[model samples]
Target: MAEETITLEVTRYRPREDREPRAQAFTVPYRKDWVVLDALNHIKDRVDGTLTYRWSCRMGVCGSCGMMVNGVPKLTCAAFLRDYLPGPIRVEPLAYFPVIRDLVVDIEDFMGKLRRVMPWIIRRTEQPLTAGEYRQTPAQLEAYKQFSMCINCMLCYAACPVYGLSPLFIGPAAIALGYRYNLDSRDEGYHLRQPILAEAVGVWQCTFVGECSAVCPKGVDPAAAIQRSKVAGAKDWFLSILLPRGGRS
Candidate 1:
């Protein structure tokens, strides 16, 4: 009896060496328990030392192992080899981003967008140290809990077609994060974040293709967040018309 093997057609590109990206296949032993990241580790450790990719926690919590598995954005750590059985699994860098090297895309754009969204609790006035903490009920926590599950994975950006067409779009994860903070009961930065979320490149840029929600591994529905933000933006705009000095809280 012979051991079964699987083929992985991985993308290879060296900026100084290769003119463009190309596929390089490698055959490895097929283990039902092995994930795509495991196979990649095997290649880097044994077969080819030059194969480069990013992976931190193999547990899929770090979101650093996101890549294109069979043309869909996925965390390689969660992608099982047995799922794509009996043959080659096409692996590439996440779509709609500039490839820095083989299976590594430049995420500076996403980082910048994330910063602009201000994904943190903000208060106009700070409470005194002796004032204790701003507490919330479990119901209040549940308001923005689902959107807070983002691991900063670029998977949503890769899955978004609007991002592919328009790079200036604020993107799914960033907007969802902004909405998350806005929904926080203790957060008083809605006025501060409104400009960014209501801008042309903000929630309006998302065409609601729904792929961002579809590919989310954390179950974060960024598509719903975008839609909800759009509604909130509209309500604020209408309130601004009615009340000259005040809009939304």
Candidate 2:
């Protein structure tokens, strides 16, 4: 069976050349199961070679190839043309980030925000030379496994309304990653990070529009993490007044 052709309106911007951004259209053929990545490749190869976009791991695991497809952040390789109403699909770089070019936004803002949270596990002691690997129970794995699924795709940031308003919100993805490690029982950094996690910008800024979880490809559920932090912060205040030593050890 032959595939159908569709039109894609891509936004283009060159800070060194153009004063502002402009939208350009390209028509390409596509199969029902074929993702937007196929049409982009066709347009880039047969139509315009200068178009800029990022992609890797054609599968959804890499979290690359994330772009705005008709005002929604999604992985191009996962966006099927058949999913749209009809032709004339609009493609653009993600919102809440500076556009470096067509469909390519500056990720530096996201990287810096993630770094501030220290997304990796911090330990004070090194593993013993003769010690075996760390053992984790099924329940323990279940506790933090969902957060481990984040691919750092920035889709959460794109969907987060807080990020759109305040660039310093710390956003959803990074906070979710931080929560993943903080929940690990083996991590001693949780105590040192308690104040960090309890900050105003940490997770309290999340408004829970829940768009972040809705758009997450890996089902990381950043909205839920933020909500969990909010609950914890609220409970801690009460525990401090009602209990001894502010519920500290």
Candidate 3:
């Protein structure tokens, strides 16, 4: 019997060689257990040594293998070939970002946004080493745990049309992470984070498209986080208007 095979339509872009991205097709033997990343790896090792992409910790933990698989943003490591079966699978670099090589999108934008959100525990004053460690209950841990699961897969960014249209938008992952740190019992950075998040291009830029949450591999609901932050910002504004001395005690 002839071996079953699958065709992959992968987007190829070389800065000096091509003006725009172009699709390159390759045929590989089909295996139920093989993923899209595996197919790309086969192409790299056996057929085309010049194909460039990024992948590490193929278990989907590193989140470096994210790509547009059949127009949906996904972790190529988790996208199985069996799901598409007997045909071509369209693979491309993530949308709304500059493709440096083949499937690799430049992540400097996301890195900058992450830093702007201050996604870390902040304290007005650090306690002395003699003090005991900060602790929390199960409920406290659960509050921010889901948002913390984000591995920076960037599938959310690819699925977000807002970010696609407006590159300056602070974006879902950054806001969701900012909310996560705000929810931390040990954090007091909400006031600090609010300035950036409450800016015109922050959470308000999101039209509640919810595609970010829909495509999140980790099940983190970034849309909800953004809406919640909006509510918090509004309440803060309302308080400032209604109370004396600017409402900030």
Best by lDDT: 1
Residue by residue across 35-91, what tens digits does model 2's lDDT show? 898888888898889988899898998887999999999998899999984878899
lDDT for model 1: 0.94
Residue 109 displacement in candidate 1 (angstroms): 0.2
**Per-prediction TM-score to the true structure, in the order listed:** 0.97, 0.93, 0.98
Worst 10 residues of 2 by lDDT: 188-197
Candidate 1 or 3, higher lDDT? 1
Models sorted by TM-score, best on top: 3, 1, 2
Error of 3 at 90 (Å): 0.4
lDDT of 1 at 93: 98
lDDT of 1 by residue, 134-203 (tens): 9999999999999999999989999999999999999999999999999999999988897899899999
Clashing pairs in 3: none
Local distance difference test scores for all models: 0.94, 0.85, 0.93
The sequence of per-residue lDDT tens digits that candidate 3 reaches over residues 1-249 is 999899999999998989989999999999999999999999999999999999998998999999999999999999999999777999999999999988888999999999999998999998887898888999999999999999998999999999999999999999999999999999988889987898899998999999999999889999999999999888888987999965777
| Backbone Cα, N, C clashes tallied per candidate | 0, 0, 0
What residue runs in model 2 are displaced by over 4 Å at the alpha carbon?
1-3, 238-246
**On lDDT, who's better, 2 or 3?**
3
